[model samples]
Each structure stands twice: as C-alpha cells, then as structure tokens.
Target: MAGKTHDFLMVSKSILPEAILKTAKVKELLAQGEVYTIHEAVELVGLSRSAYYKYKDGVFPFYEASRERIITISLLLENKAGVLSHVLNFIASVKGNVLTINQGIPLQGVANVSISIETAGMADTPENLLAGLGEISGVRKIEVIGQT
Candidate 1:
C-alpha cells in the first residue's frame, strides 16, 4: 500500500466550493474576535460544525495564510552613535514593519543586534532587504535568524 501525498493549490474565490468558502468565513470570525464559539462562528457563516471542522484546517483566506510573513535578522553592527538608527531608517524606507529589536552590549567595538520585522508590506524581498542592509555603513554582517 502507498501512503497519501497531499498537494496544495491557489484558487480564486470565484471557483471555490461553498463549504471551503464558508470554512474560511468561520476562521475569519474567530480571528476577528467577532464570535466566541465554534458553533456561533459556524452558524454565522451558514456552515455546520462538522463541515467547519472538516475544512477549517485546510482552507484559509490568502491574507490569513500569508500573515506569518515575519522574519528575524541578526546583525553585527559597529558600536557607533548612529549605526542602529541608520539600519532602522533603511528598514522603514523599504516598508518593512519593525516589530521588535534587541541589542547586546558592545564588545570589541561591535554589537549584536536582532530585529524582527513583518515583511508583508515590504517593497523588497528578504534577500533584497538583506543586500540593502549590507550596503549600509557600519553594518558588519546580516543574516536571517528566523522566519515564519
């Protein structure tokens, strides 16, 4: 016997079957905190609980599915007065939303800085952003530490 292999596809809403679309609505209701329980959400979306449960894990709106567009980058920066600010400014210029930043104490004239950013609205791809960061003065190194 052979094991099942699952494949995924991106389909436009115009052709999606009703059950899958209703499942997406249920998820949206929960995410927006508009409904408290599965039953309420399923009812609001005109879907049965069983159907919601069946398709919930498999069907998602494009935005919901791609919402995990966050990345954390670690940088080796010169312990200079404006190096960190420059890095932040560059990120803003590229439309990257900065979520968190952590900087370690300077050691040997260098500091370790980690920045987490949401890249959904970024004008450049992750690689392009990294390349731009590398071009900034005093940014010694740049590498992606995490992504989700």
Candidate 2:
C-alpha cells in the first residue's frame, strides 16, 4: 500500500449506494458501543459481513477523518434566552475545546452562530457532536463548515 496513489471525494449521502451507507452504519454501531462485534453490527444494519470487510477500511464519516483537528460548525438557533448557553454546555459535555465563537445578530427570530472547536480532546465524534446539538431545543440547523 505504500506506493499506491489515492483520491477522495465528499459526496452527498443521498447519492451513495445502499451497501456503502450500511457499511458506515455498521462501523458507527460498533464505534458507539451499540454492538460488540462486527457480525452483530453487520446484522443490525442489514449489511453483509463480506461487504463490511470490503469497505470498512475505506469508508468512514468525515468527522473520523478529521479527528485531532480543528473543526468549525455553523448553526442557526432560535433567538431566546439560554440557547447559546445550551450549545456551549453540550460542547463542553463532550470535551470539545472551544477556540472561538461568533454569533451574528438575530434576524427573523434566528441567530447565526459559528463555533471553532479543537477536536483533539473531544470524547465523541464530530458527527455525534452535531447530532446532539441538533437535538437541543433551540437549534434550527447545524453543519460542519470547515476543518483543519
């Protein structure tokens, strides 16, 4: 593998084949402690073990690739008391180190926020971080805007 050349692309999940998507799910299930073995994870996600093994080394969430780096997340939140606090608290809960935060003035009952976090110390994947943030009451939208 040392002399091999590789290329990569960031693709929308909607356009990916089912086997690839399920392979990712199987990996996630194992990573998140939802399943103890590859066999269990593959069965749970309805992915064949052979397919999982074929793609497992190559298929991973973008966040997994960005581990130990800095990531910026852009979010829109309802303009209300404690909304930003909740967001910050959630980041802290996952051991994410907040490097900078910028919140724009609210418009139409929503405020735009961008937070830069150092993921080296994060206890969870950025994918899970975004998911948890999305579940917060006032968060309108969330996405990873940049990473380094």
Question: TM per model?
Answer: 0.55, 0.68
Across 43-104, the per-residue lDDT of candidate 2 in tens digits comes to 89898999999998889888887789898999999999999999999999999999999999
lDDT of 1 by residue, 1-148 (tens): 4898655565778898999889988888898899999989988878998998888788866444434488889999999999999999999998999999999999999999999989887777666778899999999999777666
Candidate 1, run of 10 with poorest lDDT: 60-69
Q: Considering only N, C-alpha and C atoms within 3 Å, which residue pairs clash in candidate 2?
A: none
Candidate 2, residue 53: how far the Cα is off, in Å = 10
Model 1 residue runs over 4 Å out of place are 1-68
